[model samples]
Target: MLAKVLLLCCACAAALAAPGVYDAVGYAAPAYAAPAYAHAIAAPAVAHYAAPAYAAPVVKAVAAPVVHAEPIDPNPAYSFSYGVSDPHTGDQKDAAETLQNGVVHGSYSLVEPDGHLRRVTYTADKINGFNAVVERTGAAHGAAVAVAPVAKVVAPAPVAVAAPVARYTLPVAGHPWG
Candidate 1:
């Protein structure tokens, strides 16, 4: 048993020492050649480092700007509509809606490869009240509402409850025995 324990200790020490010795040898040499050892070090010394002759700077010709007489709208109404049509179940659903001001608003929907419908809605705040409802038959449903500002709510403080105390009682004998 003593010999076996010594053998195990030696095995663990060898395993721990192997990685340290291996890393020291693996990283000992540098990959790049030193500047003093390079043969091209003397080549640059023979060539003189001098600037070339100066030339006159050339000026680029500018073109005249063209102006249009027609006026264009800065904020154009962007309206788009899309829908998702499932190929497996043959169920079509609306996915997204986009609206810019009162002039334009649209919806879009798309069906994923796994028979899932994805919907999106985009609407401008120019309208008074806007509500969007997205429903997936059996998977998930969501709703969004835009309402006028309402009163703020404050929660009441919680009431504290007293903890119960454990009581112990000793039994009394009816008659004393000698």
Candidate 2:
């Protein structure tokens, strides 16, 4: 095995030192110079082909016909109201909005986390970007108190005792062959 490994290493070193490979460091000299020819060999002449002259077809963009679309009503009037009340969790919220004459007026109310009711009235228009009035009604009860859970104690069931079992062994006798 050792001899084989040494031979492989030697072969690899010879291959790496060959000419034209790893010559950037100028360590290995070229193996041999290229042979010179008596006369220079000329390349065969190939006929040149010129692409046929082509002019892109003239394309004129005709102006699309002017179309006048029906204008929409900018000052539309609309009203909507929505509310949600969950008695189990005591969550309540409602909102109402109305848009008239390019003006939006809306109001929303919700139960706050502190048990207080918060209401906001807002109005928006071109002159006044947005105006809102917030009002908090009812006293703040604060966070709800958490009650510790109680563990119930259960009595263990009675276990019935099993009767004792009896075992008997017969005396060994001499074998008939013996």
Candidate 3:
């Protein structure tokens, strides 16, 4: 057994001392030197596409039969305002406009997503920055409202009646216990 173990150890040592697999296939150190390891990554190159320059279309003006038409007034007599409502949350926006002696008076209201309402009433003009009043009204978010408790009116207690007594005497037959 000792001789067999010694032979096995010698064989393993000889195999390990031989040349590696890469050397046997002629794949020794590369002819060109390898580059050093870099810690930082290189920035990637990107190209952005833009629309090509376009020439404006030429509009050919036509000479029509000369006709005189009424000129348009820049400023109108009446004032008007409109607003759009949000569909998903059931919120609404509203505005009203009125011309008061050439001054524009407008009132605006916006219903918020959380059921709160905001209002602004303003006298707006180019000369003066909007003179406005703002108001907000609604229950605060996540705030609970207190409810008053109702007083309980208990009905009167029912009267108790006495149970009927049964009386029937048995005829004859003496016994130790009744």
Best by lDDT: 2
lDDT digits (tens) for residues 1-178 of candidate 3: 9999999999988886664534444444324434455765554343333344579999999999999888976665686888887688676898888876557888989876566789999897777867999999987565455669999999999999999999999898988796
Predicted candidate 3: what Cα RMSD to the true structure?
A: 32.7
By TM-score, rank the candidates, best first: 2, 3, 1
On TM-score, the candidate that comes out on top is 2
- Return model 1's CA RMSD, one decimal: 25.2
- Model 1 clashing-pair count: 15
lDDT of 1 by residue, 8-51 (tens): 99998898666334343343322334367546554233322233
Q: What lDDT score goes with residue 37 in model 3?
A: 58
The weakest ten consecutive residues by lDDT in model 2 span: 43-52
For residue 165, model 3's alpha carbon misses the true position, in angstroms, by 99
The C-alpha local distance difference test score for the whole of candidate 2 amounts to 0.83
Residue 142 alpha-carbon offset, candidate 2, angstroms? 6.9
Model 1 worst lDDT run, 10 consecutive residues: 43-52
Candidates sorted on lDDT, descending: 2, 3, 1
Deviation in Å, model 3, residue 168 alpha carbon: 99
Which of 1 and 2 is the better model by TM-score?
2
